[model samples]
Target: MLRNSKSGYGWIAITFHWTMALLIIGMLSLGLYMHQLPQTEPATFQLFQLHKSIGFVVLTLAVLRLFWRLINPSPRLPDGMPPLEKAAAHLGHAGLYALIFALPVTGWFMVSASPWGIPTILFNVLPVPHLHVPAALGSQEEAESFFKLLHEYGAYLLIALITVHVAAALKHHFISRDDTLNRMISAAPGKTDN
Candidate 1:
């Protein structure tokens, strides 16, 4: 059995991790910039549509990652980790999972409520159906508007959480001199779900 630390991250896990990270960075930057634009602007609508489409892809990938984790289980942290560090690691991971799942959900709900409707962007060549929500509370506009706010704020929270996560990883890798960073990067060949 190859040692976990020296094994390195499975190709799939590394692929997913890097790809999702890059995508999130793009989505967050674009989403924030696009939000600053006037709602009445034609480009604003298209920007939002692109954001929603990307969000859906992120959501799908998150679900698959969760499923992969459940099936394959993550490698254990380096032995003899301090209690506090372990706890922090746990919290960081949990927060990541929460944000990953929450982001797309909020986005989806907002798109559903959006009167303009969401557009699919498959390789920038497809238009997927807008997942619409049922009218129940009052006017569709009012509901969608409310959900849009939730989605927007949720994005900010996600960005903050990601910032914290990356900082912690750096701390572990450099300041603490711990295996925390290595563990994620060295999960054995083919063990990664990404």
Candidate 2:
């Protein structure tokens, strides 16, 4: 059964939270490891392709999640939290939402600008067309360098934001022994009036 929180998050919100958490962790790992590979290796290109594909999937899921959040609502903070902590939590979540949107857009542009052409998926069977013409973007070297820097720096920012988020979650769950983590993880819904 769905438990109710003071702010009113239910099953849908919890489901989105946990699912995104897993996907984001996988993406962060992939992004970091791929960047470490030598640029000269064929495997580096393969990893980059995989990274783009995974990023597109994350973008789709994130859009759905954001739409769902807009239609529904998030749970309220625990009543006893300090104003500072509450403000921090709110800012942290906002930062997460912003990054979730930005990362995929940048990734898509990066791929689109590559001279080698970008691959696409339509359902499980059809391939879509690449959106950008490589000639229009620039020389191969320029396109590659520009998008690589965008992707790499964007990734670093995302990593920092996620690190702070994870730390905050841990602090809430373990140190504070609050329902912040439990609001998403517990099998039961919090105290719902209805």
- Each model's RMSD to truth, in Å? 4.4, 3.3
Task: Please list the C-alpha lDDT of all candidates, in the order they appear.
Answer: 0.72, 0.74
lDDT of 1 by residue, 1-194 (tens): 22222334455666678789989899989988997999888889778777777887898899987776565536665566788977887887787888888878766666667676545575577666656576774576887887778777877777787888899889868986865666566554433222
lDDT of 2 by residue, 1-194 (tens): 34334555677667777887788788889888877889779888777766666777788889988887776646678888999989988998898898887887767766666666657553335564555635765786687677778777877888888899889889988998876776676646555323
Q: What is the TM-score of each candidate against the true structure?
A: 0.80, 0.81
Error at 100, model 1, angstroms = 1.4
Among the numbered candidates, top TM-score falls to 2
- The worst-scoring run of ten residues by lDDT in candidate 1 lies at 1-10
